[model samples]
Target chain A: MSTVSTSIAPAAAPARTSAPADNTSFSVDFSDIGRSFTAKPERGAARGSTVAPRPVLRDVSLTVQPGEVLAILGTSGCGKSTLLRIAGGLDEPSTGSIRIDGSPLNGIDARCAVGFQEPRLLPWRTIADNVALGLPRRIGRAEGKSRVAALLELVGLTSFADHRPRAVSGGMAQRASLARALARNPGVLLLDEPFGALDALTRLKMQDLLLDVHAAAPTTILLVTHDVDEALQLADRIILLGADDDADDMAGGRTGATIVQELVVPGGRPRDRGSAELAELRGRLLAGLGIDRHGQARGVAATHTIPHFPY
Target chain B: MTQTQIPKPGTAAAVRPARRPIRLTSRRGFVIFGGALLPLAILLVWQLSITLGVVSVSQLPSPAMVFLAAIDLYERGQLTLYVAISTQRVLIGFAIGASLGVAAGALVGLSRGANVLLSPTLGAIRAVPSLAWVPLLLLWLGFGEQSKITLVAIGAFFPVYTTVSLALRHVDQHLVEAGRAFGLGGIRLFTAVQLPAVIPSVISGLRLALAQAWLFLVAAELLGASMGLGFLLSESGGNGRIDRIILAIVLLAVIGKITDAVVGIFEKWANKKWA
Candidate 1:
């Protein structure tokens, strides 16, 4: 009963699959995304608690343009997620306003869909059903069924539609999760280390797939990652987090900490990892992290700079 | 504009549409249901032994005699009437028990207050077997159909209740979070997400309740019913008509098996439809 097909093959949805829309416009916007934690950075509670509150991000501000893939590069702790949460409208900014498409965001809900490191699929449903989970449940049965089938098509998973999530490989499962998030037809896609949990080969495939989908949909994406090459290869502009020479650093013995260094990728679309431009970007990034040519830090980046990551 | 369209994959080639319910319930299904040939061959051996006077005719009637009695009962519509009566009782008792049990189970499973308040009484009831309630039920309801229905209800109740509640308890938390993330709230969460999530458990409970009802109905009917299959079994035993007793036993086996098959198919259908 749905005769809503358009002349352009922009993809149909009273049929299947969901993704970003061009006419439904938005570019990422944020002003002040802060999260605070009161920690006693002491060995023991001294004299009934000499602990103080810390502002992870004092008043972070950022804005991204349409078609731009903004990569937020931060160490394990520099409030990247907090900034993303505010930008995505999933969490309220501590003190400033956030607007996407010139409209203010208020609360828990956001206009964007995010892919977490974990592909949190519903175990009870099949891969196809999981992808279609975001489709409206109250629609007519015929419309709903067709939409589900179509969503499966876009995700490159029409074959595994009947297979449960547990029955699939991790990469395949994440693909399904991406499809599920895309089903919301968001204007912006937030990816929080979506490839952080994948193997190298599969992660490359996913990155390529993401690039293809981005080309097709033109969604403004904000990718959060700890990998420098990943940021350099994929981002239109990268925001570095850690060192802040503008402030006093001797208090906690943090000499050269994570700092924001915006680097333009010089070209659009997914790039080859070892290009000369990438090498230049990597050198710039390593310089930002305060690591010497020998890969040793010139000084402690920060006390919080962990020696070795278990991953 | 340059573009490339990659076709997605699927399994559509060898898939054949099946006739919905007939495969499960046609006449051919009854012909060899549960290796009937082997059981029939055993009955033939029994008949041969009887003819050779291996055991007293008074102790056991030949299979042929049981078959003739079954035919007679069928002709008089007594078999039909009894099957209908038992089926009705089972259905009615199942309705009461499953609905109430599922409701109570869901409440107990989802709400801390309900679990804390109602667990003691439910645990006590579940601990006792349905047979133990026969005498008490007879004394309370006076050998009427209520006693039998109540017994069936008890048999059906505990299994469904336990399964549904346990199913609710074990639902994947991510799915629940997804439901919440979708902006589903209030009654919508329970109806759309929680209830559907717990369906496999409910179906398992329903199948269990069906099996229990068939097995328990006979014992429940022992409390002096006038015209149920259990009553007929009692009367046949009293008269020592071994053939009629054997026929009743065969009838119970067939009825229980048929009901169980129906419920199993239903559970499968439910999974496919809602899932």
Candidate 2:
């Protein structure tokens, strides 16, 4: 058992609503985001010629209502992670801009906390100390310690407080990562495939944990993932990036992803795991990726059904 | 069938459990005895060779004779004094060399400009043998304690420098990113993340440097030293006191092992704590 009292207020519980109640919730706005990297020209190019920039994302625009769970679904190399990074303020878009809570984001947005694909826990530090890392220096030591204890308890890892990360299992470490991210009490949480590395059982459990966490805090979430089921399971809205039809726009250069489909997931928390609507949404997401159950085009609505498999 | 059944009444089919054997000795006792076996065997062979007159007394002394020589030195208060002198010289040399090496390594590791400017020279210096420092140090510092200490210091420097720099450069990238996400930067990042990460590597380097320091102590004492084990060995050789020479060599080996064991314990503890 942790030294913290059980009455530490369950993480500022916000009512489950479509819109943020007031100024307490943070909103994210991505306006015409595009990113590119310059690639050197191959041999035999003309002298003094400027090489073209390889576009990873282009014309991506979206908005996350405060306290909404928005899952960005895309295949590999579709720049979903890059978009998340841009939103988190760890990266800058080559063009366009992002605004958080009606304020322009220039550097790291102190109100936003990011959980990466890897747990990224410091190996030398105890699990408790690693969780404490999320708190800013402004938080007093006693306060920070209590907050860390509360988080460890919330994550069901209070017993392992003194243990180093190497001593824990992978799923436990990922839970610790979640606890660390929440330590800042950020209004916006950005997760990049946080459960991608776990097994099937662990992934399902983690999804449930994420829902529990969101219910307790009601912070806005932006999750980037390739897993269709995961998006349908947790998201209030799903945004599909890098539609197959957009490839022609590049004309043999580099093609970037854009928001091709925006979906509003119906129903509420504790929804059926094998719900028919979720299965339909999963099918639709797969079809949006230009593949059907038989790996063929879905109906006659598909022209560029075969996504370009990058060599 | 009836006769066979009746015959089993005196002999029970189920055997009683065998009484446990009485304990003969503890495992540690056996381990110590096993460890001493090879040394005892070698001593026996050495004594037997001397008794059989296979080696002349002038050329090689028996184990008993060396024991007498050790006792003689101990009674004269010379053994402890010389050992103390040699130990102190090595300790001081190692302190200077190791501190400088670590400082230089860290500077090079943290700054690209420092690495580019200093690595070439340091690498070149590392290639120079420990024995090679004796002459230059003698010429520069003259025949005194300074030259001897410098030789040992040179021996201790290279390993620590190499290990520290390499470890610093190879800190896990993910850990750095994690630190940055938490608002750690600059010196705070280094202390909180990088320093602890490199401790295990630095410990290994210290162990290597300690061994090298011991190796160089003998060479260091070979230069114009009136005391210490190395000087004792040389002086005893000049006087054809083979027993004393053998005792010095044994003492050096035993001391080296003891020091290395101490560092080994530290290494194990650090690895368990940090790794």
- Mind listing the fnat for each candidate? 0.17, 0.50
Q: Identify the leading candidate in terms of lDDT.
A: 2
Clashes of each: 14, 0
lDDT of 1: 0.71
Question: Lowest-scoring 10 consecutive residues by lDDT in candidate 1 chain A?
Answer: A1-10
Give the docking tier of candidate 1: incorrect
- Residue B184 in model 2: shift from native, Å? 0.9
- TM-score for all models, in order of appearance: 0.67, 0.84
Compute the lDDT of residue A242 as modeled in candidate 2.
83
RMSD of each: 10.8, 9.3
Q: Which candidate is the best by TM-score?
A: 2
Question: Each candidate: what lDDT?
Answer: 0.71, 0.81
Off by over 4 Å in 2: A1-24, A38-53, A243-251, A295-311, B1-34
> Model 2 scores what on Cα lDDT?
0.81
